[model samples]
Target chain A: MSNTATDSSETTARHNEKMKRIKAARDKMMAGKTEEKGLIIVHTGTGKGKSSSGFGMIMRCIAWGMPCAVVQFIKGTWETGEKRLLQAHFAGECRFFVSGEGFTWETQDRDRDVAAARNGWEIAKQQILDPRIRFVLLDEINIALRYDYLDIDEVVDFLLTQKPPMTHVCLTGRNARPELIEAADLVTEMSLLKHPFRDGVKAQKGVEF
Target chain B: MSNTATDSSETTARHNEKMKRIKAARDKMMAGKTEEKGLIIVHTGTGKGKSSSGFGMIMRCIAWGMPCAVVQFIKGTWETGEKRLLQAHFAGECRFFVSGEGFTWETQDRDRDVAAARNGWEIAKQQILDPRIRFVLLDEINIALRYDYLDIDEVVDFLLTQKPPMTHVCLTGRNARPELIEAADLVTEMSLLKHPFRDGVKAQKGVEF
Candidate 1:
């Protein structure tokens, strides 16, 4: 990188003037954004970081001293570093609920999978209703809804209407239902531009988990 | 959710058979994935979760007992919940470094911005070479590169060639340069389908932070 670019006072003055205009516009825009409410955030797409972002949000909630819960829906028994870390570091501050035997194709038992999703939702509902709970991460619940293991309408109704107005909620998974997306306040699609797995590289332990 | 769909023996058999085929194909694909190497992961786009994903990766590293460092480039001195949480829970395991006055348009001083980016890069280089450090998050460095505060080619060469082969790295920001994207192993673009800010909703405290 260039350490210095011949500090020209004349050019600096012009740039400063341009910045002044930008700052004024930005201040005006921000001044209008006065409403602050808990968001129904959806992280869904054919890429990584759906669950990772949820974990990060949980981290933020824990840092700010908010009671949070994570319900890993349609998950496996495999131990994830994120789960271990949250349990170890923020134990009481955050709670974890893991259900299901893995992905749908892997399990191949629709009854068992449906039972698991219902069990997870039971836990999620309790957390969502608890006035003490400030955040809930419905991790991979979209996959359950995709498989018709859970009713999207029922889930959306409880989240958008029954839950406390200030309780933040995040749902993450690939192929999120349209109703859920329509109900979400913020929807971020993590588009997969490139993945190392395509190059015959297995998932790395800490990074992938 | 349907409690049960009348356990049909023939339907169950068909599902089981189809799943077996999928498992076999999945196993064959996984058998070829033997390579294990550090990844240059990039998270960029005009959406949320770029930094959240990076924070989650850092959490993963910490959980797995890997020493990590985070360098917030071109950032203002706003206190983030992620930074505070990392410092409070895993101080010795992870380090935090923040540089720059803020955004390029806001700072309006090219020389000072360049100096700050360079300073952050120097710290990043040290962290990358440190054998003890397993992960480093170059948070918002893309913005610094976008403003020409740091040379993208120089940064890419250092990260791709000089850094330890086993160490993982992540770059987070919107509008990442094409050169950096070319060198990265995994790239996820967080596309903003909907944002609350556009509807006059300010960022939430714990959730957005």
Candidate 2:
């Protein structure tokens, strides 16, 4: 019994020492670390989680009292939970723009969808160039371009010409254009390795949404 | 010339009729649908993007073409562009939990944060209770149990209760209770947020990440 106790005590002491070392290292790393300006991140791919990753970053910034905006293309008519929450909690800190009419073919009005897409793009452009809006996300801009709902050259030019000293831009969607990829400082491509749809299972609540 | 034009017109009319009818029906319903699924969603606010409005839903389900597992328990984090896209793309196919992550001091024990806040509830348990993961997102779970590093009752009970119907599970972090949140469908969270340390400026980065 005595030997066992002694051995346990020794282990405890060693563990405590190791923990102290870890804390010291963390403190040291934090000491010199200063916040840099910001980055423009483009998340695109055929896989999943691109937008989720970007939003996770946005949440962190808001926690620290940041300002931001979001402009989406290709969807309208749905009251999303995110929009509700943003309006309720981040009231003055964020702005949102949805396509407001679903897809062009679904609406049977290519002209209307194009008009909404353009409007959404215009909002994104304003935010991208705004000095006050530190972060601007052009969600699904890639899809809009792919569908020819928005002009790619005009969008790319705007992104390239934005004021670089303060603003950070994010673009999320699949089939990102080569031009956009070339212009971005950081680009991530999500690839689909496996998915549940192959098994013929339907979307589930909480898991699929 | 007249004969040729007439023939072409007749052919085009026949081809477009079927497409037009389908498009019209789709447009009418899609234009007035609610984006989010009505279920027990938990967007528990403690992490950075607990309520970035179901980003996980968009990433795992819509973008990746899978089922969904989503619980959002907070109402904020909507500045970035990703949220808009998710709403537009994944409309009417999400479950949400929208409650703030409460407060910091509410859960501060390392162990408690792990077990109860992270893995404590049966919500996460039921979520990952399958081997056919379509998309599982535990939004803002870290802040719920208060940063307790471990909470046996919360974590163990939930894990024990979990029986994944599919395989994909995601856990977002921000003060992630290591023990509890780790036992997730999928786990990821924001590590950095631009803050005032950069010359007393506000948060920046494509609208905060």
Report lDDT (CA) for all predictions: 0.88, 0.52
Per-residue error for B201 in candidate 2, Å, reads 16
TM-score per candidate, chains pooled? 0.95, 0.53
What DockQ do you compute for every candidate structure? 0.72, 0.11
Alpha-carbon deviation at A162 in model 1, angstroms:
0.6
Q: Write the per-residue lDDT of candidate 1 for residues A94-171, one digit (tens) a residue.
A: 998898778777887767878899999999999989999999999999999987779988999998889898888999
| Fraction of native Cα contacts reproduced by each candidate | 0.73, 0.09
lDDT tens digits, residue span B30-56, model 1? 899999988899999998999999999
Which DockQ value does candidate 1 get? Answer: 0.72
User: Model 1 — TM-score against the truth?
Assistant: 0.95
lDDT of 2 by residue, A62-177 (tens): 54456778776754664544455556656677777776375445555555656788889878877777777777777777877876668878877877776465667778778888
Model 1, which residues run further than 4 Å from truth? A1-14, B1-13
- Any runs in candidate 2 off by more than 4 Å, and if so which? A1-35, A197-209, B1-169, B172-209
